[model samples]
Target chain A: MIEIKSLVKCFGPTRAVDGLTASFSNGIIGLVGQNGAGKSTLLRLIAGVYHPDEGEVLVDGIPANDAAAKAKVFFLSDDPYTPKGADVEGTLDFYLGLFDIDVDNYHRIIKAFGLPTKRAVATFSKGMKRQVFIALALAMKAEHLLLDEAFDGLDPLIIDAIKSEIISAAEHGKTVVISSHNIFALQRLVDRFVIVSKGHVAREGNNEDIGTEFVKFQAVFSSPINEENIASLGFRVISFRKVGSVHHVVLLGNNESIEAVQKAFNPVFIEHVPLDPQEIVALEMMLAKKDQKGGEEDA
Target chain B: MLKHYISWQIRKWWPMLLIFSIILTVTALYTNAFTTMAVRYYDNGSEYVPYYSFGSTTSNMPSLFIVGLVLSLVMSLFVFSYRTRRQSVDVFYQAAYAPTTIKRVRLLIGLAILLLSMLIAFLLGTTVFLLRYVSTPAEEIKNNIKFVRISVHWGMYFLSFFLTFIFVGLHYLINCFLVSLGDYTFDQICLLIFGNIFLALCFTSPVIYFDAALMKHGVLNDYMWYPALYSLGPVGPVALVTTTMEQAIFQRDVAGDFAVNAVVSSSIYALGGIGALAFNLFVPDPSGEHADQAGARNQAVAMIPHGAAAVLGMLMAALGLINDVSVLALSILPIFGFILFSVVYYALLALWRHSFRMKKFDLICYVSVVGGTLVMLTFAMAL
Candidate 1:
């Protein structure tokens, strides 16, 4: 179990992560957020790479930034470390030596990764390197696995291979936290997530609850409606994706907002959006927008 | 596993190893050719004397080796950069799992390289000596050929390997340290490059000096107090093979020369191996990134002031001036820069260290130590 609380980090004039709190235990946590959402920073803090400015990150109630705490978590970054001038065997052996991985474990992972047993790692492909990392991490037996976009740069077959490993690790009572942009793809893998918007835990719960609570009801109006009328519907449209004439607006409100939309527009297309749990990610952001710092900045 | 590590090291670096070997052999051959050519073609009657010495009465093995070593460094750089991002060669643990002690693994590999170099040097040198002896005309020349038939002594090769191993091992080990540091700037990268050059020169200079000395006596132990005594120790035995060639092959009475060469070569072998062992200790391993500097951070706040650091630095510079005013005059910028870097770094470390909440006793002790050291250094400079 990994627990994070009161985490705050600030860049010169802006707060990157402000008063955030969340917890995960014995399951996958899909930390979904936008590009500059502080997900990586949060993960690093937990990994002991970055210490929190205030508050603490913990694993099983022990301080996470401590050395022993870090040992329990394996944070695999999107950018991998390539050892200088070593062949495949040398590279693997070096890591195996460093990690104190058993000899049997080393041989097993070498074969499992599908990396050549004797070739230089320099000769291996990018996908092959990722496999090496997976193999090493798997053999190391870390209880918490953290990945930042592990799916990128992998072929579908390798992806399945990695996914199976991740699932297996989780089944052994490990906690996996994956950060990515594609919430829909993540939906199939993650059991729950801490929805982050504007640098705080805006929402944290089951996917089913997130989808039921936040609904985006769309309607084609006969004429332009005033902001007050739209506000009266007791719904909020954070942003919308436009395809020609139709605007697929995102809203954070209860299901009643659909009826309000149908009454106001009286349009031809009144199709109900089958409660897509994935859609709640956007809705969660819409709701969190209330506390946005409201400044345009890119990290 | 360790044996396989060497195999991997050798296989991947076979081209480099080949190039190094070929260059070394060619240099040895070139020296022999130069001596032979001078004797055969030079008009001077002195050239024909079998016992005639070159300009310094010492063979030019050192000069040739300088060129060969340059070639080796170039090869190493190519290897380092080309595969910098690919495979990591880590030292494994005792249980045959992954590398256990980074230092031990590096040293172990360094030993292997030393042993390999020694074996190669002995074989090549001994073969050339025997060939030269067989070709000589007189029975006495063949007998004297033993003097020139020196192979790199086991001792000299050992020393050379030991010293060279550290530099070579460091070439790989520091990568882990630099990677572990993780927050390196372009300047730091440049610094690392410069550091490597300095390190290479420091380690290789000894070996080079010994090479020069070995040319005369065909023995590694002959040269003392030469820079990189350790370096010279390893390769000294090989020099015996080069030194005795003229007397052993060309001179009619050569048994005496062969005996001397054997003695010198053996000394080199012994010293070289011992020195290589010491050099291996300094190699830094990069594999343990996480825990290596786990404590380096969170301890930056307890240090002395920049101004004080500057003054003491200048005092050291003044002493370094010796009798040459001009040398001292030109040294200002470099000296000042060194001082400035130290001062700023120490202060920064203090601040970084302070950021972590400290327990009362630890904080008090840290503050006192930092404060006291800075004050003492400043006062000494002031006086």
Candidate 2:
């Protein structure tokens, strides 16, 4: 179990991770955010790569920066470090010297992934490099695995293989926290989603709850209704658009708000649209942006 | 864990170490052979007889001092290079060992390599010298030689070797400390060069200024500068070694006075090395966040050379005034020096921030440096 409490990290004037609080225990948690949304910063903070300017991170009841805690966690960065002129065997020896890894599993994964043990990792393709590091992370058998951009350049086949490996690791009681922009891939792998925006958790829950919270609707109205009317009708609008007098809106309220939207619009036809995991995350990000703009105006 | 780390480092760095050792051995052999040939001469006694004068074994090992200095610097820079890159830092600093342990192991291994290389050269040079000279007929050479003064005994050889090791150790320790203050390889190299020169100037400039003041009073003697030159920061040990070697070459009794001087200077340098070691181990590792961000890791340490140069500039201005230079020249000298130092300072700051547009903090630091320099100038002029 890794627990982050009120973590705040800053790079000069820019606050990268601002008061972010989250916990992971024995399951795959997907960290979904846009570019520069502090997901990488948060992962580094938990990995103890960067000391937090404020707050603390604990892994299995020990401070994350502690060597004992670090031993239990393996952080595979987006661009993992392989020393110059290091072949697969050399790289493995380097990591194996530092951490206790399952040698059998490491060799098995290397063979399964078809990574040449004698070839320099620097000569490998982008996906191959990612596989090398992912294999090492899995072989480490650490209690917590923090992977940044875990599936960035992987092909569909390798992605499925890695996804299955992550699932097996999670099933064995390893807490896996992955930060990636591949929401579609994440939807299949992760048991929970933590949507991040502006360095904080905008929304976090299991897949079922996260998907149901932001309800999407397509409606046709007799009279034109702006976004303000929808909000006034008590449907917390995430996004509202009009195409040829047909209203399409995503709202973040309960079933009552759905009814209120139907009653207020008195639509000629209204239909509830189911949001996929990607659509839910997009709506959450849109809502976050709106709130940010509104707060800036108020300030 | 430390054993494994040492083995890994040795494997990575053995090529460089082997090359350095080879260079040292070749140089040592050449220097010894050259000195031996230079001392062997034909004396005009009856018929021309070949005479050999082995004055000092210590002076034959100049390669130890010169090559050891190069090895010290190169090893220090490369040994701590992991601290200069984010990728390297991520790999090394995230190891399952404490940061202090990592640093300690690296320092020990660096020192081990340095000492090992020097020992190889030293032993090889000594063996060659013994084979060529010690087995020769000593009585016959002494009778034929007119200037056969072997002033440096075996004990002096031991003393010289011990002091040389201390000198090289101090150089490596201080170099490592300077390297730790930077966040990039170029910055680290700049700091190593600039920091040593600045420290050397800081120690020597005051004595030069004082000598100029005394000269103005007509109380200066040539020998009066010797005591003042005895503690020239990193340069002090070099001067001590050269002076001792000179004394030995001249057949002077170096045991009484020069040995005391060498011991005192080496002690001071040892103290300095200790301080560097303390700073190197105790400063917080900025980790991957500050890697490759020159001057961002330790602002206070980065400002040290600027601060020292500022004060040294004032002392030079004072030295000019006492030397009876024109009043106008004296006034322009410090202003010119200040501008030159400021340009260098700003250039380094630009490299650190990767921007020419100075931040408010940078401006404030510049102003503080200028203010501190002015206050020091005032105190000196008042005195």
Candidate 3:
């Protein structure tokens, strides 16, 4: 288990991270935030690279800063910290030396990442570099591992490779924390998400909760659809478009409303358009903004 | 693999190594030419060398040799540092865990090679000094040996070579300060020169002043004050000498070689080393949020305040020429200012600029500041 207690980091007058408090118990956890939302800062604080200006971090009920606490946690960075001018062999030697990592495990993970074990990671492409870091995290096999922007810039195959590794790590009972803007990608891997906006944890629950409670419906009709009829169907009117005989309507709500609209509209073509991950991300951000506004109004 | 890391360091230095070798060869030839000229000149009626004087009240060769030594030493430091810092900090330090004793051993071995290079350079510097003012072609074997013996100890630059390592190593350790100015290449040169000049001035100022302390101790005690020069290991007050700020934190009575107690001043260099260690030991975990890269604050700052950066640089150089006591200590003063400026102003500008979109000129501003600071400190201290 890992815990963040009111963690804060400030850059000049602006806060990069603000009063973040959360805990993860044995599972795959997803952290999501927009650019500059302090997601990486939170991860770095946990990794012990940057000390929090306020509050503390704990590992398994012990101070995270302690030597004993650090041994169980491994943090993989968004951008791999490859030794400059170091070839692949030199980098492996370095990590193996620092972590006292076993050669068999290291090589196995290296092979798993599909990187030539002998080539310098510096020479590898950005995606390949991320793979190397992921490989190291898996090999460390620590009780807890943290990763930032774990999916950005990765090809689909590499992403799947990493996704599988996360699954495997979780299967082995090691807690994992991953952050990404790609909600759908995250939805597939993370059991739950901690949505960060304006430097605070705005939401916490399973992806299913967000998926089921907040849904998007798309219906196409051969006949022209009137706005009044769409309104009569009783679904929030997100948007509508017409192309010759085909009329399209998009709605957001629960399954019952969607089913009722499906029966009443009697559309020729009905499609449950999976909500864009970014759109859901935007919706969550709106919730955060609303929360802030509510707090301001109260104050 | 650790061996590869060390070799990479050495390879980075290869060009500068070649430069140092060339300088060493030239100095050696000069040393040989001058010493031979000194011997040959006295046997002839007139001197064979350009500036021949036998028993002058004030000597010229010591000054020349000191300048040559300082020049060569500073140059080698430049080469060593450029090669060392070219790699990102993460890569080099990642190798620290390579093996027990590997890091320290590599450092000591690197130091040895540097020491040998300095020794070769100093020998040539000595011969250059020896031939500067010769009388006849051959002054006789015994006469030349005696002359060489009296002034030749300055040729023992190897003694102070340890000091060079301490200073250069501290430069590597305190890369934060180096990175702050935002100009890695010029910033490093600035760092090496500023540090070397500060210590060199501290150690040599008293000698140039012919201060009362040295007058009372005589030339020999003056040598004692210079632990590196006297072949004395820093063990007590003698040990007060250091290359970094760490010594001052502990209040060690470091023996200052030139002006102030060298031991005390070396503490400033030690301070830098400790800072470097602290930074690496407490690396932050970014946890894969993925939008971040290592702080390129300098790159960000390079956009604003190019001229003020220039002035601050000028001020740093001015501090360099002050007496050894001041030079050794004051060299870092600008460093503190640079860090403070970066910490304070970077944030202000960052917030104001908030998604601070940077242009090329903005980046140039910081590079100028970094490069200019180094040049400023170097010449300013000379004054």
Candidate 4:
């Protein structure tokens, strides 16, 4: 388990992580955001790579940077480093010298991934390199594994294998926090979502809760449903599209408000369109952008 | 665990270590041969090669001192570069030990390697000399033994060799200071070159000039206050070695005075090195975030206290030198000067510049104020 308390990290004038506070229990957490959204920086802070400018990150009751706290966590960076002259076996030996890793599990994961254990990791392709680091992280059996871009540069089969391993790890009560731009991939793997925007968590919940909060609907009315009438119906429209008499609307609400919209329109045909994980996140980002522009204009 | 880590580091850089060891030994042997040739023309010269000195001071001392210094610097920088490169720091320290512990272990290991290398060089040089001496005629060997019996002792030679280790320690201290300046190739280069230059000038050139001045003023005749400046150069230690040799050869007692002076000088050097190492160990690695602003703040803060002290010290010392101002007035003036400079330079310009980002005009003002303060301090010191 990890807890962040009003954590703020600054890189020169830019605040990379701004007053972020959150708690993670033992589970698989998916961190999603656009580029430059502080997702990677947040993980680095939690891993104790960069000390915070203000506030604190605690693993259990210990400070994240403490030796004891650091012992429980492992951070697999976007580009993990391999020591000089180290092939797969040598690299494994090197890490064993530093940490008490499970050798049996290490060999098992290596075989499962089909990585060439004798070849130097520097010779491996980018995807193969990621696989090597993933195997090490899993074998280490650390209480907390913070993986940046966990599924990046991986083939479909490899992705499935890695996902299964992550699931197994989480099932054993290990905490795994994964950050990636691939929303659909995360949608399949993560039990909960943390959406970051402008160095802050814009939204956070289980996938079901997120789905309930954001909905998309399609309707066909006999008569024209103009902008004013749609506004009067009072479903906060995220996006609206019309083709002839049929209108597609993306909204922020649960089933009750979506139902109210259907009753108010009295359409010839009405269907609730289930949004995929990407669409839900995209809609939220659009809303946040709109609010920012609105605030700027008012000022 | 610490021992394992140290051994791992040593093995990791074994190739470089082996190369330097061979190079250092060859240099030492060549230097010893050159010194032996130079001393052959002087019939009264001692044939007893000082275990530390190896018989020739003028020809051999600088070269031997230099071998130790270069070996220490090269190894220190090599270890520093290997351990503190941006890539290594991020990866190696990510999951492992605390950074400070790693730094300490590397420093200790590097020092040990340096000492070991010097010991090897010394032993090899001594062996070569002994092999050459064995082939000399019995009459010549007897004559050489007489010289050795009069001018050399095991204890004096041991102390001579010990100075080389002290020089290595000083080099290590400088390397630590360079590491504290953040990880940048340009900064590292500047520090290494300038640090060597500074030490060379302090030990060699400045001492000669001071010696000439003292001789002209007959200040050497007053031994009481003269020892205060023993820390100025390599003079005191070098003189100690030379005087000990003279006392042994001539059956005199200049050893007591020169030995005390050398001890004071060496103590100052050792204490300075230890202080620098402590500072390097204590100062945390700079966080990249707001690094520029943080550096500026630190510089400003450091400058104020230093500037005030420099001003005060210079004023009092200058007044003392002129021999005009009374003791009471001299002491009071420096205190007043310290407060004035601290308020003007530290409180006003440094604080203001640190508070706000500088525009073109503001930058000009900041530079002017800093330059003006420096000029004033320089003039006062010269007085």
Candidate 5:
């Protein structure tokens, strides 16, 4: 378990993660956000790579930066570091020497991933290197695994293999927190979602809930409805677009808002589209941007 | 595990190790061949004379040792830089080991490699000496070659190892501190250039000027005091090494005073290493962007006073040198003056940082204290 209390991490004048308070238990939690959205920073803080400027990150009630706390966690960064001349086998040995990894599990992961044991990792493709790191992380058998951009540059087959490994690790009661922009991949793997925007958690809850709450709707009206009429609806509109008489809008509200839009517009036809983790994140960012614009106009 | 890690690090450093080893082997062979040729040419009886040394005899081993030490230390910068390069920080720092432990491991590996290189060079140099002089016929040795003075020969050897180790440690400490200041490559380059310049100035023969001035005045204190003062800078260690060799190997009585100066010089280096280590600890590790901001924001407040103190000390020392005053005594004064000025300057910077206001009386007192010291020094010089 990890408890982040009012965590704030800054890089120069820019706040990477600001006053973020959250907690995670044993599960695969997906952190989804756009570029510079503080997902990586938050992961780094929990992993104890960067000390928080304010508040704290606690791992099982121990301070995250504590050696004891770090012992239970393994952070595999997006661009994994391997020495210039390091072979896959050498890199494995280097890390295994530090952590008491399960030898059988390590060998199993190596065989499953089909990574070359002798070739230098520097010569491997980016995806292959990422797989090697994934293998190493799995082998560690740490209580918590924090992976940044875990799915980048991986093929579908490799992704599936790595995803199953992560799921197995989670099933064994280890806490896995992964930060990535690949929402579809995460949607398949993670049960919980933490959506970050501009250094704060824009939304956080069960992954299914985030997907269900934010609905994408397409409606066609006989007569064009003005923008004000669409705004008057008591729902947060994430994206608003119109082609001829058809309006394509993504909204955040309960089922009542969907009904209200149907009743108000009395459209020729209305269709509700299912939302994914990516759509939820895009909608949240849109809402945050709208709020910022609204405040600026008021000022 | 530590041994495994060290061995892995050694493999990484194989290229540098090989280069140094080759240099040592070649230099040793050349020295022996040169000595044999010199023995044949200087066949005035069978004296075992060294070709390299003139009246003041000493082998080039001490110089070569210093070269190897410096090269090894320089090579370490590359190895250390790789530890923090790009994504390596995340990999290393987030490992099961603590950050300090990782740093310690790197230092140990670096020091061990440097020691290995030094030992290799020492052994090669010793082999050349033994083969060229000790193995030769006794009659031939006695006729042309005078045996090296045990004290000078052994002292040089000891100084080479001692000074090189201290220097490598000091160099490591400085790099560790400086790398935290900014961009790693930029900081390393700036430090290297700055260090070279500082060393050049230190070795610029401030002692030579003082020695000449004293020698011209027929001062009896010329031999010991002037050399000791000169040994205060970077040249001090080099002088200490060479002088010890000169006294013990060449059997020069005049070198005894120099050997004393060399001891003082070695102490200064030891003190310097301690100071660098203290400062290295004082500076926080360059972990996050916070340190970068803080370092940049406080650059003037932190660095200006120290820079001012150094420049002022140099000016005062130059004045002492130009006035042909007591160089030994004056050299000591500049060091004390540097400390005093640095303390005062730093206190003022602290006040400025805190926006502390001084009363008119307090301001007057500070000015008087600073001005009074200069005035008193000038008065003393006039007297």
Candidate 6:
């Protein structure tokens, strides 16, 4: 288990990770965030690559910065480090000195992925490089795996293979935290989702919990209603779109709030719309942006 | 773990070691051979006696000193370069081992490589000299006189060996400290070059200025300034090496004095080495997040040497003006000197900060250094 408590990290004047608090246990958790949303910074912080300016990160009851704690965690960055002129064998030797890796599994994964053992990883394609690091991360058998953009350049076939491997690893009690912008890839892979925005966890839960927390409603009101009126009706509207007098609204509330919105609008016709994983994440990001703008205005 | 890391590092850096070894060996051989061939014989009445002088040998091999210095710097830079890249930083810093252990192991391995290469060259050079000595024909000398008068001075050999290691070690430590001051490799390289030049100037300029001042006051003459000028800073060790070589070749019983001087110089540099080591091991490692962000951190500390150099440079200029111009011209010299210092200081500050627009901190540091230089110049004029 990895625990982050009020973590804050800054670069110059920009706060990359600000008071972010989250916990991950033995399961695959998807970290979804937009560009420059601090996903990479958060991973580096947990990986002990960057010292936190505030708060602390605990891995398995030990401070993350401790060597003992770091030993149990393997952080595979987006652009993994491959030494110059280092072939696969040389790279493996380098990492083997640092960690006690499973040689058998490493070779097996390399063979399965059809990666050349004699060629330098720097010469490999982007997808191939990602595979090499993923194989190594899996072979490390660390208790916690932090992967940033693990599936960015991978083809669909390799994605399925890696997803299956991640599932198997999680089943064996390894806590895997993967940060990627590809929500679709993570939809079927992760058991839980963490939506990050402005360096904090804007929303976090399993699919079922997130599904219940956010509701999408399509309604045709008797009169034209602006977002202000809908918000005035006491529903926390995340997104509102109008098409030919038909309203499509995503709200952050429970079923009672959904019913209250319906009663207030007095729609000619109304239907509940279920949100997919991508839509859910998008709505959460939109809500975070709105809150940020509101806070700036208030300040 | 340290053993494995050492092995890995050595394997990675063996090519560099081999190259330096070859260069040092060739230079050593050429130096020894040239000195041996330069040996001349004089016919003194009945016997042809060999006249030996090794001062020319040390003097002829400036390349040896340069090789050692460059090897130390290049190796130190290469070894610590992992800290400058985000990817490598992640790999090494996130490893299970403590960073201190990693850094220490690297330092040890780098020093080991440097010393090993020098040892090879030294042994080979000594062997060649001995072989040449033994291979010299006795029949060529009339009246059974020795063809070469000098025997191998084992004491000097050992002293040279000790000084070589100490010199290279201190150079490595200082280079490592300077390399760690910048977040980017380019900035680190600049700091390494600028820092060394600045330090050399810092040591040598004051000596020159004071020597000139003393000469002007009639307290010292040109002949007396040589001892004081050559016996300090980087020059002191070089002078020590040459003097020791000369003493060794003459078979003089000055080993006691030589040992004292060697110890004193090494002790002073060793203090610097200790401070560098402490700074490297104690200061917080630069963040990978700031990798490539030049002048992001340590800006003030990094600028210190350059600032001091600027002040010393201005003083040197003033001293030059005092000698070349009349009292009337000297009165207005500080203003001209200050303007020149400001222009150069601003340009260097731009390079250091990587921007033309100076921050308030930069302005403050600049003003302080220029103001300090002005005050020092006034003090010198009053004196």
Task: Give all candidate RMSDs, comma-separated.
Answer: 13.0, 4.6, 11.8, 8.3, 8.5, 4.6
- The reply for model 1, stretches above 4 Å from the true place, is A3-22, A40-71, A75-140, A153-165, A196-202, A218-224, A232-251, A255-274, A286-290, A295-299, B1-383
Listed per model in order, the count of residue pairs whose N, CA or C atoms clash below 3 Å is 63, 0, 75, 0, 13, 0
lDDT of 6 by residue, A1-299 (tens): 89999999998789999999999988999999898989999988888888899999999998888889888999999998887778878779878767768889889888888888888899998888888889999888679999999999789988988888788778888999999888878877888999898999888888677756678888898887888997897778788899987889888786677688778877888888889877887777777788888988999
Candidate 5 TM-score, C-alpha based: 0.76
Alpha carbon deviation, residue B177, candidate 4 (Å): 2.3
Judged by DockQ relative to the true structure, which candidate is superior, 3 or 5?
5
Give the TM-score between model 3's chain B and the true chain B. 0.36
Q: Candidate 3 — which residues are off by over 4 angstroms? A: A61-71, A84-86, A117-120, A215-282, A289-299, B1-383
Question: Which residue ranges in model 4 land beyond 4 Å of their true spot?
Answer: A220-232, A241-247, A263-269, A284-299, B1-7, B37-54, B57-61, B82-86, B141-152, B194-265, B288-383
lDDT value, candidate 2, whole model: 0.75
Ten residues in sequence with the least summed lDDT for candidate 4 chain A: A284-293
Q: Candidate 4 residues A1-299, lDDT tens each? A: 79999999987689988888888888899888888889888987877667899999999888887767778888887777687778888888777655657888888988888999888988988878788889889887679988898888678887888889889888888999999877766767888888777777777888677756667778898778865676677767778889877798877676776688778878889888888888876776677666657877999
Off by over 4 Å in 5: A97-100, A291-299, B1-22, B25-58, B141-183, B199-233, B244-262, B278-284, B288-383
Q: What is the per-candidate TM-score for chain B?
A: 0.37, 0.77, 0.36, 0.61, 0.58, 0.77
i-RMSD per candidate, Å: 9.0, 1.7, 7.1, 2.7, 2.5, 1.4
- Candidate ranking under lDDT, highest first, comes to 6, 2, 4, 5, 3, 1
Worst 10 residues of 1 chain A by lDDT: A290-299
Local accuracy of candidate 2 as per-residue lDDT tens digits, B245-338 = 4454454664445545655665677787888888777765665688777664656776665655554565555555453443544344655655
* Worst 10-residue lDDT window, candidate 4 chain B: B288-297
The models' CA-based lDDT, in order, is 0.51, 0.75, 0.54, 0.65, 0.64, 0.75
lDDT for model 4, please.
Answer: 0.65
Model 3: CAPRI class: incorrect
**Deviation from native of the Cα of residue B160 in model 6, angstroms:** 1.9
Better of 1 and 2 by DockQ: 2
- For model 3, residues B1-383, the per-residue Cα lDDT tens digits are 34654565565556655565566557555444544333223435564442322212112223323333444445434432322332222222222232113334334444455445555555555555455534433333564553432222232233343454354444444433333223234433443443333333443333433342343335334343343321111211123222222233322465133434444445654664567545433543222221122223443333323433344344344444334435444455656755554454344334323336545655556556665655555444344
lDDT of candidate 5 over B138-158, digit per residue (tens):
443456855442222354455
Candidate 1 per-residue lDDT, tens place, B287-343, comes to: 222231212222221122222233334333332332222254323343453455455
Q: Quote model 1's iRMS.
A: 9.0
CA-based DockQ, model 1: 0.07
Candidate 2's error at A193, in angstroms? 1.3
Reference interface contacts recovered per candidate? 0.02, 0.48, 0.07, 0.32, 0.52, 0.70
